[model samples]
Target: MSIPALDAQGVRGPAPAAAPRATTPRRSRPAHAPGRVKVWQRWVSPLAALAVWQIASTTGLLPQSLLASPSTIAVTAAGLISDGTLPAAIAVSLQRVAAGFLLGGITGILLALAAGLSRAGENAVDPLMQMLRALPFFGLIPLFILWFGIGETPKVALVALAVSFPLYLNTFAGIRGVDGKLAELARTLKLGRAALVRHIVLPGALPQTLVGLRQSLGVAWLALIVAEQVNADAGLGFMINDAREFLRTDVIVVGLLVYSALGLLTDALVRLMERRALTWRRGFLGE
Candidate 1:
């Protein structure tokens, strides 16, 4: 047997070899991780519902007068599209919505800025706004008709009124909710009033403002539907009203679907804006 090596102090044996590390098996990621879900999965429920509806209609369980079959509605929609009627109505509705949105958006932002920036403005503006918000806006249709008449003005004004409150409330809350420490830091850095507002306040309030925008858009469409009932000669509301006179349930359904589609499109646009604008924000939903 070989003798163990020793030093001047007479230590006996070589250091024991280091133990080998145990390897752990890696875990496979969950299929349901954020953004990992397939796009088709989202449509499954809606498609299934639609299929059930079609089957029910085909089996005569669902009456056409109550709600037309999906196939009938689809055919009617195609006919409307082939002619210029649907396109013209859509254009008119789009114009009205655009005008109302612009008018209301500007008014809301200005009011929010005024109230948020000054105690005097808040005292002067907020009470009136609060009182107005308390009242059902639809109740003002008669007053609006008296003031602006049964023309497009009243319709647009009603939509504007509906759109304004949400934005104003949200923007005001967002401005007030901004971190005071950030404002203090801004002051510490000697930021001017304009610079502070432009750089800090507006950017800080944007997320809430976008949320308000989505709410306002939904309200706007609802308002448009009600407003158009008051003597609209052109637009989806007019088409629906005309269809009601002739008992054309499919046309009415198509009009309602168009309204829903518009609302969804607008909401989707606001969501996209939120994603782009709030890239820096990380909430419970991981990117």
Candidate 2:
């Protein structure tokens, strides 16, 4: 018997329709790397610029006497390294910066905390701090030399000045910016002063404090450079100054390079510390 065509009325169908094929699974593209190109790009521009400078100096487009080539600078730096003078200078400069930055940053934070927490403290201290901040740090250089006499004392004092204001301002701002509601809640709960600060205030203030710390570190380094260069001293800054006097532009360039590299390294260290200290701050920019 032959099969009849299927219809609405009813008849035998040829066969059931085959099930539709499923679509091929989509393949995901690989994830793009974060901050990769930025790393290379930052270096590329500087290297290219240095190459152009080297070419200009080599071709006499810039006079050798006025602008030293990279190779000459490298050689001069190598000589200093071999003789150990550069290393010693760097060590001394770093020591002064460390001592002063620690002392100043700590004191500033304490004072700022006091001023921010108590109206009486603010009234007594903030005015003097403002005045002190307004005075150019370098202006005190002469007095420091007079009192401390061209020793490490002057260098340390200068760095301290540089470090203090940033820390104080930032700490004060952070403390004051703490949420009033939290304070009220703490009071309602009958939390002790220490408990209130430890739980509520410090965590809230940490991000701003880190920012101030980074800024203070930069200022400290800058101050160290200037302080180390002045009067009867040895440092990267002094090396640069001395090189300029003799027109050893190569050595001067080397000194400058060292200063730049050291600044970058220290900044990187601070960022690493920040990342570790503020684990909760991840996924948020500027935290």
Candidate 3:
């Protein structure tokens, strides 16, 4: 049997061997890892689809009357842009959407705050909101036109209506879904009501509130499309309607493309906002 080794105030079977120092330096991952897909790679699929569409249109597999060739639509879009028709229409549409979004967003946040902060407010507000939400908002077009007249008021109102529900629902859910432990901690910390809400509750609820904003924006566009169809003399919807009467499929396609592009642009803006606002968030997607 081996005899134990003894040191000052210590005893051991054998002297401990020194841990070997690492020969190779440890490699650390970059703070912002590269995306799985390259930037150019992301565009490949869309470009391929566009090429196929152009080929089909050129080969007469797709009829021009039914769907214009991408080239023809591009030309039509260029002409409209040069004539300032597209810009004017876009401006009008944008104004309506912006106005409506502001109004609806304010209403939603207020309602959500009220219901989220108070049981009595929730009892009074939630049931009516839920009932209103159950109905297809698009179905309210006739009623809106009658009440607000077949003008800008009805169009703006429609967008507002479309925007409000998503925001209200999501904001309410976010407020309620705040971690109970965090709220308890806030209380334990002796946080004032204002301080608790400003620091803890609002920050915690912000992620879902932002999600609601995105959804509301999407629905707002859809509502604007339908609203503009009602007695619209200007805007993309009017442009499409005018093109339809003249059997100008190319022009119609251009208008539709513009609508799609706008939707994508707005969504991208929201995504950028999320990246900036939610820097603390890390999930599978972030990796």
Candidate 4:
């Protein structure tokens, strides 16, 4: 028996060949799409600059007397490392930096807290702070030398002075910028002063405080460098000066690069801290 074709019936019309199902187009991702990390892209500029620098130095397009090549700097750094001089200097410099940073940071945060939280405190502390901040930190070098001598005290003091102002300003601003609504809410909730500060004040101020920390750290480095350069028995700056006296451009470049690397490293550390601290923050990371 032969089956009858459905097309013969106008009601069915062979079901119209099931009509081709429409397909969704595959989408091309945007360049900045999250989770797409192009790690190599980050190095392109630095590597290109290095290539240009190497070429310039080797081909005599740039004078070596002025600019040392990366390779030469690397070799010089290795020599310094072998002699243990660089490590010793690094340790001393880092010690001074740490001491200064701690002193400055503590002083700044405390003052900021006192002033930001109370009008009386502000009246007492803010004027002196503002006045001192107006004075160039480097200019204090001569006075510090006279008072503290060319010892570690002056260097540490300078670094502390340098670190304090940024922290103080940022912390004060951050605390003051906390939403008044939150304060009122805390009052409404009958929260104690301590509780209000713990829950509402500090957390809210963290973003700006971190920014201040970064600035303060940069200042600490700057102050250390300037102080060490001015009069130092030992430090990275001392090495640079010694290298300068001997016309060891390579060594000078090495010390300079080391300083740059330290700055970058410290900045990176703060950035890492920021990421961890602000994980609750909503932004491009979607966190």
Judged by lDDT, which candidate is best?
4
CA lDDT of 243 in candidate 3? Answer: 89
- Tens-place lDDT per residue, model 4, 59-145, is 999777888888888888898999999999999999999999999999999999898888999999999999999999899899998
lDDT of 3 by residue, 1-287 (tens): 01111232122211121122223224222211223234567799999999999999999999888888889998889999999999999998999999999899889988998999889999989999999999998899999988998778988898998899999999999999999899999999999999999998889989999999999999999999989876798888899899898889999888888888999888888878887888787454347
RMSD of 2: 15.8
Count of backbone clashes, every candidate in sequence: 0, 0, 0, 0
Model 3 misplacement above 4 A: 1-61, 282-287
Judge candidate 2 at residue 36 and give its lDDT.
Answer: 41
Model 1 agreement with the true structure over 152-228: per-residue lDDT tens digits:
89989989999999999999888888889999999999999999999899999998898889999999999999988
Rate residue 262 of model 4 by lDDT. Answer: 90
Model number with the top TM-score: 1
Model 2, residue 116: C-alpha shift (Å): 1.5
Give the residue spans of candidate 4 off by over 4 A.
1-52, 55-64, 283-287
- Estimate, for each residue in 1-287, the C-alpha lDDT of model 2 and write its tens digit: 01111231132121121112122222111112223454577798899999999899888897767878988888878999999989987887788889999989998999888898799999987999999999989878889999899878888888988898999999889988999999999999999999998998888788788889989998998888888778646777777788778888888778877888888888878777878888775656333
Indicate whether candidate 1 or candidate 3 has the larger TM-score. 1
What Cα-based lDDT does every candidate model obtain?
Answer: 0.84, 0.80, 0.84, 0.86
